[model samples]
Target: MPKLSNDKNSVCSLAQKQCCIRSLNSIRCDSGVTSAKAGRSCEGDDGNSCMDDSYQVCCSCCALGLWMRRQGQGCDADLHLGPSCGHVFLTCCEEVEARSQLPLRGQENLKPTVLPRRGNGLCSQRCSTAGGRVLCSCFPGFFLMKDGHTCEGEAQYYVDECAMRKDRCGKDFLCENTPGSFKCIPKQKCLSGFTQDAHGNCVDINECSSLAQPCSSSFACVNTVGSFNCQQKVLVCNRGYHTSPDGASCADVDECQMGSHACGVGQICHNLPGSYRCDCQTGYQFDALRKVCTDVNECWSYPGRLCAQTCENTVGSYLCTCTAGFILASDQKNCEDINECDQKPCSQECVNMHGSYQCYCRQGYYLHEDGLTCEDIDECSQSIGKLCAFQCVNVVGSYLCACPPHGYVMSANGHTCTDVDECKVGSHNCSSEKTCFNLQGGFRCLSFDCPHNYKKVSSTYCERINCAPNSFDCQNSPLRITYYTLSFQSNILTPAQIFRMGPSPVYAGDHVIISITSGNEENYFSTRKLNSFTGAVYIQRKVREPKDFLIEVEMKLLRRGTVTSFLARLYVFFTPSSI
Candidate 1:
């Protein structure tokens, strides 16, 4: 077999005839003719019938190899000098026959040849055939790269479709981006009780107006963010009714327990079901105008008819009192008289007065100094001769008769006394010539006559005779006669006369001087010359001692050639004063 040319550019630079044949054997053009000349003839020469000329045949196959290269096909032939011209033509003709089986117009270069796929790690899908070569592409949701051979997954983010293509979606719709592409959906699909805002988001629903109201008649509907709720209303109670603790239910109100009643002081309030009443207590009566209880005075109702003597009225009661000499009985309404002499308060006799008593003594006795005791009266000493005859003796409440010492007896009158004549009764002891005399207390009998210097005045009675002249010491004698002796108590209020002494016969030329000679001297007793013949003694001061005072007052008289003197004694008994 002959070898064909392997130089592609040189082979394709030939005429268009027989372009489909490439593989062919080689031949010698008349033993020395060159291969270039043979190639030239095959390019333009048309061969006629020949007696199996190898050079002409070989040149026809060479022209076929160049035509195949010009049609952009590969040639697998070796171009070298050989004696295989018929076998090369047969091989070229077989390839031409295989390509001719396709459609004749657009299928001129088309073939059903198998394409070898490329090994691309970045390809995300299977390989496909295009124009007799393998192409790498992506699966669904992916895209091809710029080199047109590798594939990648689609992008997850959205892109502005309007910015890219202004009319991407129509006016009634909005463009919504998907993972790899975009679509157009309706602008709004809002739910019930909800509305879309300007920015295309669903907000809350106002059930108070737009939808049906869900609250009751006594309740109110409130709207919230995307929801609504119902609230119950506050209920009001009527008069005498109050709301319960839960502020929903109504209950009856008790005015008495709540201290809302109009009861006054001292009035009791009684509670009823829905009202209250007032009542008064005992000893009190209700007053309509004052709405209170008033006290009733029972004492002033019946007056004095309730008591016997005197009636006094008090609050709800009365009192009684009796008159003089009477007392109130235990019944508190009656009076009883009292007996004043009931206890016998007198010693002898008791006489009842109206409200007192009087006491008296018996006939033989008299009321004592205390008036409650009786004592005897000494009648004999009270009246001397009227109570007795000769001598009176006092007895209890009476007098008795008594006799004298010389033998007297009582007369018929119990208080008289009489003397008996001794000679007539023969009770005397006189002789025949001797005379006996009877006296009240005694009787005497004479025996001798009196002397010459004394004369007998009566039997058994004699007195002293006058003194003789010059027979007495008249001037010098210390014994002077006391004419009158006087005794008096020392009770002189002022300078008063206690005693007086004077000469017996006052003469015209007589003069007397008097002086207190004894006693406590002039401290108690004093004297004064009253005239020329008399002298007077007096108390000088108040006597303070309970003793006897013997005051001697001396008087000296100057007479006609004779001086006579006398002394006066004053017995002043200084007894205690009564006051």
Candidate 2:
């Protein structure tokens, strides 16, 4: 066994070599003391020969004690591991001390032999030795690296203390992170219309109460959300004037345009800048006390000088009127005599006088009891001798002689009657197919005709002669042809019945068809059956001018299974409307 010396330098020199030996052997010592025998005591400055197992164990314990002391841990009292240590411990101890004092190096270079039981390891920040392994962690603003032995700065692996609920900021403060640390700042900043209180809260600023004379003398200041408003004051103006929009001035009001003036009838109102004037109309006088316009009576004021005749006074004017037989002249102030004859007041004649008129009658008339009317003399009854050779008639202001109603007319002497030649004068209503013969008081229309294969049987009827059994021409021809004449004025209405053809004595189940066979080229006539036995023809179109139509109406009668046709020669005449 080797003996250890009592000299501090020699002992420390021996402890360094032994510590290295223990480290190489992977041994651990908790109290900086190894579990080995005490080494042999080595004297003097030469302790190199003290290599005993006990001395080596004791020296290793001494070296560890010195290192622990440099790390701010007290060394074992028995080791004397202060500045008095020898060169053996000084070299290794100095090296260990140098490494421990250096700033936090990388994880690979940081190695500590003995660490504290709880939070002590080769870590940049917090450390733990749990389950025989060194684990590292960081503070609120720092983060642990992958090595589990080092902590990264806040800039590299940033940790949001606010988001992670690890900040120490108050409720009114905002937490902001920095390198390896955290900061607290006020949460809100005061803005316009708001002020910050002692507790850092924003409160509304009452500008209306805070400012001096914010509004003018005529306005009232009112505070609003984030602003202020000034409202105008109410004002009253004098009569004939009104307040302006801003309540700062006054403006004039027009009484005439607004119809507010107290001007009476017959007065005109005129407007001034701020007042009105009332004036009287023509022929009216204004009464100042009554404030009204009164009519001027010219008749009483100027009498004869104003009008030539009568004078009258009216509201706002005067009038000049004439007498009963005179009129007002164009000058409106004089009168003139009216020509009464221009009005034709008399039945026969009229004559004008200075201011009146006269009425008279002609030779065949006499003035009535009324001076304006003239009545006939009735010469037909009042005459003393025969005045006419025919009947006498009286008319207005004259007398005349009239002939009989037919076949007679008055001669040129206007008193003798003469026969009228109806045929020569063409006055009879006879068609072209008939002859008109004059008689004593009337005229006669005669028509005589016989168609081919027919012979006259009577004055108006024609009979067919003998024919062969198979002669269709003689058989089909009318067995009897009758003549008819119709007369109408041109003013007759359309659709007039002109002729009716049917059997004289009819039996049952008798039907006839009537049609205008000729002289209806203009389609003016049509036929219709009134009953089974009677058929009639009508003038369907109006004849506006005097005309004649000779239509042959044929009626085919079917009676008792026998068919026989008859012909009627109708002569239609339209005379003048006056006849």
Candidate 3:
């Protein structure tokens, strides 16, 4: 029975005689393998310790008296029943961790030891389907059972650094793999505004404006994804609303009068941030000093362009300029009607009012163009005031009931002064021998008929021919008469003493007839045709010793021809009587 060998020098000389027979039965041999036969097996030895030492050679192998206890052998102190109950006992307990190295049994063919060990004890070690089935040894997250029947230090691998990354767990994990363990468990998310935070890591929960959304009566609640939708954004659905799906619910955005928003038209709507604007119920706004939407420019309450042409800007404000000659109206603000009669501006009749227009002129007229329109101006044609002093007459709109023509009358009210009598109502024919005077505003006709010896001197008097027969004697006999008359009526004398007269004046004894009488029929020639002169009526001849009687008078001067006028009458007749 001792010839058995897995040869390595016969198993190192039978492992030194099986360690000197378990140190002479002081027993302690277990590096695992066993089988039994009335065994006291400190487990480990393939052929089942050589088939239990071949029955210990037929019974000596501790035959029932159980004594193969080696190493300093102190035999049998417990776990009894070792007396061949068909001889099978197995025990193995191991602890070898010193830089670990245990890789033994592999000559291949060994499989049937189907695991079943739960802390069993006994030196009855039959863990042998050929040497690898003696199991028991553990430590770092352990697990070993190839029929080595169980050794488990596991359950400790929750090692979380988000290991192996599969959907990264931890909101209460669920990745469970056991052998060398792996765990995590709880997952199912979906909340923020109702959906889609697709694992960018949980926690987001918006449920769309939250409060479980059933919105609609003027509704609202926008929480997407895991559910909540309903939105009719504004107005009407009072006391706890319940109509949804476009009918409205949750109600209350009316920040103050909102057909939903845009507060403009006497405004008010202020929900804030995610939307809602327009504001003006406290006396209006955005008018930043009349920049628009209005309520304030109080015209600055005091000074400037505020309304002469218009500026009525009020509410919180304004007034003034709504009347004179008017202008303002394009909203420079208020008081309009500026048709100052359509801008023709007006020199006269323009009175349009509201903001202003009144230039005046129509009764018997006055004003032309500059004040604009009511023109009709003829104060008798611009004679304005001197009015007909001499000629003016321009009527239609005014002036001219005339005056000035020697007799001057127009004063009964056609604007003026009177006096045209030429002497008491006979209206002047003057010559039944003179005088008709009524002056100041015209009339004076006077005639005296002082011819024959000329001496009236009253009634517009006359005195010429002072002749008492002083000596213009002519005896040439056609009548033998020698008459010389008194001189007289004279604008100074000699056209032959004016046709040989003595009073109507013309001398030298008359009969020296010289005739070409046309200075307007030259009778006393009406004062030389009233001073526009060139008068001459003549007859000449009286020259016999008067020491100086050169009375030469020949005439005709209209385009001039034949004319003479000489008069040297020094007929003093003698005057040296005394010193």
RMSD vs true structure, all candidates: 54.5, 34.1, 40.6
* lDDT tens per residue, model 1, 96-154: 44434433532443221111112332212223344655444433223466766433432
Worst 10 residues of 3 by lDDT: 570-579
lDDT of 2 by residue, 1-579 (tens): 111222222222332345334432332222123221111111112222222222233344344444445566543333432232233344334444343453343123322232111112344433334566544444332345676644434212445556778789898898986543469988777778887787878888777899898888668888976668899877787788887666666768888889999988878888876788888887888788887788888778895678876778886678888766778889998676688989999997675543556675543356687878988655548863445544667779877877667666677878656667787888789998877844434466776778788898666668899888999988888888877656655665678665666764455698898888999998989999998878888878888876777899998989779788998887677654321
Cα error, candidate 3, residue 111 (Å): 30
Per-residue lDDT tens digits of candidate 3, residues 1-579?
111111111111222335324422332212112211212222233332323322221222222212223222233311222222112121211112221232233113122121122333211212122253432332222344454534333122222223546444565556764322345656555443333344545554555554544564455676654555666575455442333555534434444444555456665567753355666655445765643455656555544445533344557556555444344556654344455657656753453432344454433444444545454434546655655434566769976655556555566556544545556767666677545544344344533344454455343234444334543432110111121111211122233423321111122232222333222221322212211112333423332321211132222212123222222111111111100
Which residue ranges in model 1 land beyond 4 Å of their true spot?
Answer: 1-475, 483-490
Q: 399 in model 2: Cα distance from truth in Å?
A: 12
**For model 2, what is the C-alpha lDDT against the true structure?**
0.60
lDDT of 1: 0.50
Count of clashing residue pairs in every prediction:
16, 14, 83
User: Against the true structure, whose lDDT is highest?
Assistant: 2
Q: In model 2, which runs have C-alpha deviations exceeding 4 angstroms?
A: 1-434, 437-447
Ranking by lDDT: 2, 1, 3
Error of 3 at 541 (Å): 83
